[model samples]
Target: MAGQIPIIPFGPHATCTLELCPIEYSIFRYRPSLAANITFVVLNVIFALTHLVLGLRLKNWWFSGAMVAGCVSNIIGYAARVFLWQNPFSFIGFLLQIIFVGSAPVYYTAAIYVTMTRTVENLDVSLSRIKPKLYYVIFIVCDTGALVLQAIGGAVSTVSSGANAAGVNLALSGLIFQVATMLAFVGLLIDYLIRYFRDRPVASVATRLKLFLASLSLAILLILARCAYRVAELSEGYNGVLFHDELLFIGLEGVLIALAVVALGIGHPGLVFKDGQANLTKAYSPVSVPGGAESGVELVGK
Candidate 1:
């Protein structure tokens, strides 16, 4: 009995522990790095608190709420990873990480979509090919679908103990769908920017506006990259080489998403848009020009 492999339950609710099973029985094939997962947990907590404070101070409810939710999901997911570090064969921990971490970015993308709508309206609604509100409706709907798919897939995979190919395929499809949606959103954003710049060229762009746009763009690109990596990792299923590579997972999943979260904070729309909204109100007031015409609202550059 000393050399015999222990037979243990293998579903999401498995009762197996390291004492009963060999490390090879774990899906990860190695213990999760406690230091790395703990770092991620701490980072997510800091970002969540920061967003909560900023949201309350600025009354930016929607953006702040979405960011806080995403960060909380990351915290839970990484905490699950920490659980795995302690007990490498924990199926529940694996389930929690896969479901929460995989779906967390959907909230971030929703936040970005709403911001884009506001950005288009604040800058030049007429320049956008579609109505500004459509951006919110379209992207958010797609993001929600991706989140649902991922959650369901994770559940299915856990119940099957990674044996059901359909579950892995479902998760992969969700990630791929998310990547496609982001690409489309980025395409539309670029188109709108080109049209706006061509129609209304400014002599000097405001530093605040530049920083906001740059940070937002950086976050978008990073999230897109992370999603793409997830798609690749899931394509090979749980037993694949890429699935077992912790270094790649840490870099692409943990580090990239953390940077994206920081970018979102840097580009907090409340800071940039608050003044612009006030200026917009004043511009739209029934003020008269010297030429006996109504004053037109110009885009806020500062």
Candidate 2:
């Protein structure tokens, strides 16, 4: 059995002399953390349910759908961890967690990008360097690209028995791309906020708008931190020392994402937009006139 190559369905009797599967050998070497996995599963379930209820009540279909997708991925990812806890050799479980959890945040960030567009529309679109629609177009497209790279890389790694160096590189590239997109978004967000406040008196800004901006900013920061940590983790190959640090994974990946989801709930778009209440027809209007007529042009030059 010592000389035989390790094969799937690994067990005590298998001829595969390999000490552990590369997918999550660090986790398998020691029993997977049951408590940590279960906690994440529960947290994701709550986040999913809350978002669904709020989304339906507020009629925010797009936001709700993205959050639901992320939650489902989290559920599957942690459930995979639970399976690994039972049997570290479960290849299917390892693949499930790796792909789903790794890409789940992409959906969340996309939702956030959409919200940014809405924010710009709601608050002085003239203040932003980029138009509201372009924010959605640019960031969502970038998010899609990141999601594809990650999904492809994860699939390739799974097919290669989790030993492919190319797969890791592809995934790392996706993470790095995501980080760059987020940084650019932050720059735009800061610029818009600064210009809006400087041009318009602070007293004109609504308290609710302030809250929404604060909440969105917090979520973005949390996500950026999580993605940065992931980039570092993957920088080291699968066998890198980072894999052995369960606490780091739990804190950076699990806890940070969980907080971001919850922050979104607190700062939900529904709170500000008020379900068909905002006059989107006047979103880019320069001024309001009698009979609810808006100035036809956005003459305020950027």
Candidate 3:
């Protein structure tokens, strides 16, 4: 026992430094990539700045705020990863990444939810089953719930140093809830589009609207995919195979979300909505009744 190296416990309370403990003892079981994380940080900063400028210029407050917040969360999360690259056993770094990175996409989803209302209102509000405003209200509320779950789970995991099953389960529930919410949102969007095009042929669809819809759809799908991946990764808890797969994390979590952020920028409502307010008069003008009375009703009233 005199010549043997002393084994150190790995956790927040662990006195193990990188010099003392093996990297395998770290929560991730591997060192986080410095270059990859730094790249994510840079990408998020650029997109965040872009959204900030555009949001300010067009006064798209909600969209801008959500995007900026999401990007900032990403920045902080990846920065934490950078710290982990230096010290894989760092409790603070692990906690930051778990909490911030895990919940960042909720903000992106929140932005999309708000944008959907405007998109439906601009295209044809009557085609949607629910009021355009309800899209944000319902989905944003769900997103908030998911965020709260994930945040609490992350906190518990940190406190337990990644050994708590309940904490992992709570986070997994959040991801699953988020994925389900996104699926429902996509279903409603597709339903609206189907009804819109069926009633008023696709040839009449504006090019701008088409691009916005395409970008929006792409963003939704990407984020949904990422959320699904996260759910799978968290399913096995901290020591799961997918959880330790750096390549999977990079592709699924990092690349997928980065592309989604880009898609959101391309499909920003300010550029498509033309001043960001629905032309209610145009969308729902007065209709002439048989008795010669002008009734204020939507053209395609539900």
RMSD of 1: 4.2
Q: For model 3, how does the per-residue alpha-carbon lDDT over 1-302 read when each residue is reduced to its tens digit?
A: 88875555455676667888888888888999999999999999999999999998877888989999999999999999999999888888888888788878988998899888987776667778999899999999998898888889878876787689898888888888988999999999889878766644444455556677899999999999999999899898888899899999999999999999999998888776545677422334343334666434222112
- The alpha-carbon deviation from the true structure for residue 115 of candidate 3, after best TM-score superposition, in angstroms, is 0.8
Which residues of candidate 2, in runs, are more than 4 Å off?
1-28, 200-204, 276-302
Worst 10 residues of 2 by lDDT: 293-302
Colliding residue pairs in candidate 3: none
Query: What does candidate 1's lDDT look like per residue over 1-302, in tens digits?
Result: 89865476467556667787777788888889999999999999999999999898777789999999999999999999999988887878888988788878888988999999888887668788899889989999998888888888878887887789888888778888889999999999889877755533343344566577789889999999999999889889988899899999999999999999999999998776663243343223233434666434433233
- For 224-297, candidate 2 gives per-residue lDDT tens digits of 99999988988886667786677888899999999999888888887667562333331232434347654432
lDDT assessment of candidate 3: 0.83
Question: What local distance difference test score does each model get?
Answer: 0.82, 0.77, 0.83
Off by over 4 Å in 3: 1-9, 280-302
Clashes within 3 Å, all models in order? 0, 1, 0
Stretches of candidate 1 exceeding 4 Å from the true structure: 1-6, 13-15, 199-203, 275-302
Cα RMSD, each candidate: 4.2, 6.1, 5.1
Which pairs of residues collide in candidate 2? 6-16
